[model samples]
Target: MRWSKPLSALALATMLAGCESIFGSGDEEPITRLPRALTQSEQELIVASNRFGFNLLREVSARDTSSNIFLSPLSASMALGMTMNGASGETFSAMRSTLGFGTMEPAAINAAYRSLIDLLLGLDRNVDMRLANSIWVDQQFPLHPAFVESSLQHFDARVTALDFGNPASVKTINAWVDQGTNGKIKTILEQIDPEIVMYLINAVYFKGSWTQEFDPARTSPAPFHRADGSQHPVQMMFMRDAEVRSVMNDQVQMVDLAYGRGAFSMTLVLPPNAQPLRQWAAGVTDEKWQGWIAQLHDGKLDVSLPRFRLEYDEVLNNTLKAMGMATAFDDVAADFSGMSPRGADLFIAEVKQKTFIEVNEKGTEAAAATSVGTGVTSAPPTFRADRPFLAAIRERHSGTILFVGLIGDPRSP
Candidate 1:
């Protein structure tokens, strides 16, 4: 068997809003042209967000020492970034800094994301990857025209108005998520609360075959180490290829497993010993992450990896609050004035994410969804996981990590 970890994010909030005529002409709007080149600031922002994603990974891992974790910070960031477009003043400042966009202009951020998405979606014809965003507004609420246009032009979000108080709306939104994630996520919105006025949803899906597929015949039962110094039997997949790229230092060893014509790959980081993965991940940073990639060279090493699968769900309100996005979750302090006409009456009520992943000898498949809700009220919301291992799926060109996981036990179903 092969091991793969799929990830998803969901963010939901509520507010009052009405749609205006500012979404451009007809049912079909001119496709917003994306720049072929990414500015230095745009590039920096991508690097910064990757750093934040890993930091957030450590925070989530710290919660359950024995459980597994899988997440897509990209999904979370993109969904929240759409919501952040409407945030102003302190709320904007707080979200900007927390999401790692910093003091960068919102226009640049959106443009960069547009370009980045286009780049990733078009990177490999052999890899199936899709990134989608949508805004569901209550028919009774009045949304700003600019918010609608920006979402359309920059994020390619499908803006729709629905009766949020009706049960049918829940089904419609959930259906969209399901389809966007290739049905890996069946339902992101179970029941729409009466207080919920809007939902900014983002979904990501990826499927790719290994460039050099591993032979199933080489698989064997191997002894896997645990954090508690115990040993368990696991089906370890072995690969010994001379073309593999790897880097090692006193702290850790890194290996690159390519996929789909080499546009993307799984980067596995191993600690020097069977130390608790949480401890090892705490030291991970953008510099260290980049250094590992930079130092990678063609090297031959026997790679033995366990075959496993993971399904993870996480509530990120407290996590985001801890990460300095507290005000966005605060009902009184939160300012999403730029999003809806009733901005003063709105605040983020919840931010949730669900993810799934599977990896095997052939390749990998993963999915993630993130939903952000602004409402009249309030709410909030790994890997290895072998002996506790860290893994990330990244695009080779931009080094963007789409998924991060930690496995605690390969035996867990």
Candidate 2:
């Protein structure tokens, strides 16, 4: 998510005159190259984020044939949602009325979602980025009795291991996933618990474009050797380029690239001669990623990639605590009295997230990206991520960490 695009000082107040042409073609015609319109929801942002992560994993996931798959501890960890059911004790009529989109106005739902967006996108100037998450399941979640009852009790949400062949449920959940993922992913929580009350979810998915877009013509069925020296024919996107960047400390040769639609990008770092990926990933930090990216000087390069897919599950209750959202997710410390009369008692029960993604040449192969921020260096309308690198979905205003993660591999881990 690059924000270096320049905006002309030709203030819109004067530029909007009938005589002035806001469009870049100079014919007053609208510019077709403009980016897509900013959309809604933090989880929607996650769908975008997953797409990007899926893309990068293609190149980096194969680092160790024995155990080179990448699953974000952070990705599998941080999640937030509030669901209420069977309110019998406290007076939650006002809040309960908002059950299942029937009680709450779209404006209210959008407002709550926007509150998260403001915080998640608060940072953009820094380049450290991997995956981000924020999701709200008000309309899609089933109409639980808790929404209309009093003194709501608990909440929970789960992404299915496999899709349940249902019509309405599939349609609703898939719709959100489709829009959030820009058609890259079609089903997110296909196995949603119909009995649950409410779901407020958010996530960030990202991956850069391929330095070398896999030419369908060259992709061949080859045996991707495993560390155990075992081999099986796997459909791999293969290319050979000579100009990739090299690092000395890790003896890793790497480069960067972007996925289709220019939505997200990634940089790949491989051991000089196939070093163990496990050892390399163990020491990863936000700062080291920045340093590597800072050293990338554009040069001719050759690259190879593979086709991949993956699904990740996380128990985010703990990671959120590590990140400072403990009080909110904690039942004992929570102060959601504004949301329920039970006060500390009416706190988050469990936040579980299951996110899936696939990477290929066809535009994120199911991707999602979301950000908001106003930085000293307004993000460039364009940034090409064709190597091993770090990226973030900054709000552009607040520069917050809405969602972040790594995609060492998109294959099921």
Candidate 3:
């Protein structure tokens, strides 16, 4: 429960990138954060978006690495709606450097990642335009521009529907979440201010299958050994599968596996000889990160990760400083002098993130929802999250993850 090891600002920034797709897929249509102003060409944004999506998938496969994430793919689902205000621009760039090996030429990687950037940028600016079309075109679930607003918040990009630090407006946000999650997660924003415009959010969510599936019949209220070895009754989701990754590290057996479509996966560390380490040893570094990745081999073992749902609604008010993004949030030093012709003062209002996850043997079912709103008069773009979803906040041009989160668990603390 405690990632005690402090991640250096640079290291934490690098680590956050590893969480783009805590649970994700490439085939799903995107649920965009609307209220985008697209006066500039998105050529760069569009191209980069596609590559970013694919690279996200590749990252999922090499789950053996330090980062286990999936950037949402819905951004690339549609193209016509990527432009707005009757103007057209495209974005194309990638964050391959965020992954590994800076061996390739910068130009080549940029070209490859631009496809993804396009999609991410498209969602930010052109999503409302696309959503207007999708409600009629999409059959299963669709949404309208429930609310709208624009700001030169994060640098120069005009942002809309941001609820970050406000504590009074949870109802509206709750409605959207209720809609997007199909009511799976309710009142997640109870503690948030509907007026708070979230500028940056980073969320992580995951669910893992037990190597040995729990027998429905064997399911019993067993006392789970706490970090203190104390007992607590927990519903053990058990499953026995021959297909599993096994690694013995520090005498502990680690079982790691992925969910369907490899959207997001989980890795479990079990203590051996009933001896647990002092904390999770989250202090595992780049070298250990590599070893954990290499240890995935075919093996058979009985495993039981306490069946539980753990979630974190990370409010990045302090995280901004944690990730070196403090300037953007500060009213004084912040220079968002590009978004508006008026040279608008761009300061982050808030960065609210909510994540929910349930772990079971079959697979994981989760959703991430985030709305970074800016201070504006026009009723902050209404974003009704009413069904299952995955959301992101990125540069309309570069497509970096400003924030990402999942919401599917019904239980909220």
User: Who wins the lDDT comparison?
Assistant: 1
Candidate 1 lDDT score relative to the true structure: 0.74
lDDT of 3: 0.32
- TM-score, candidate 2, is 0.49
Candidate 1: where are CA atoms >4 Å away?
Answer: 1-37, 377-386
Worst 10 residues of 1 by lDDT: 12-21
| Runs of candidate 2 exceeding 4 Å displacement | 1-175, 182-197, 203-212, 225-229, 240-251, 259-263, 271-275, 318-329, 338-343, 368-413
Query: What is candidate 2's lDDT per residue for 223-262, written digit by digit as tens?
Result: 5444445554545554444333333344445454432222
Report how far off residue 72 is in candidate 1 (Å): 0.5
User: Per-residue alpha-carbon lDDT of model 1 for 169-266, expressed as tens digits?
Assistant: 88999999888887778888778777777888988888777666667798778777877778878777767643577776666777887766676788
Error of 2 at 83 (Å): 12
Q: Compose the digit string of candidate 3's lDDT tens values, residues 272-379.
A: 454433222323333443355466576555444444445444443453333234444445444322222211333445444444444433444444433332221332
The TM-score measured for candidate 3 stands at 0.49
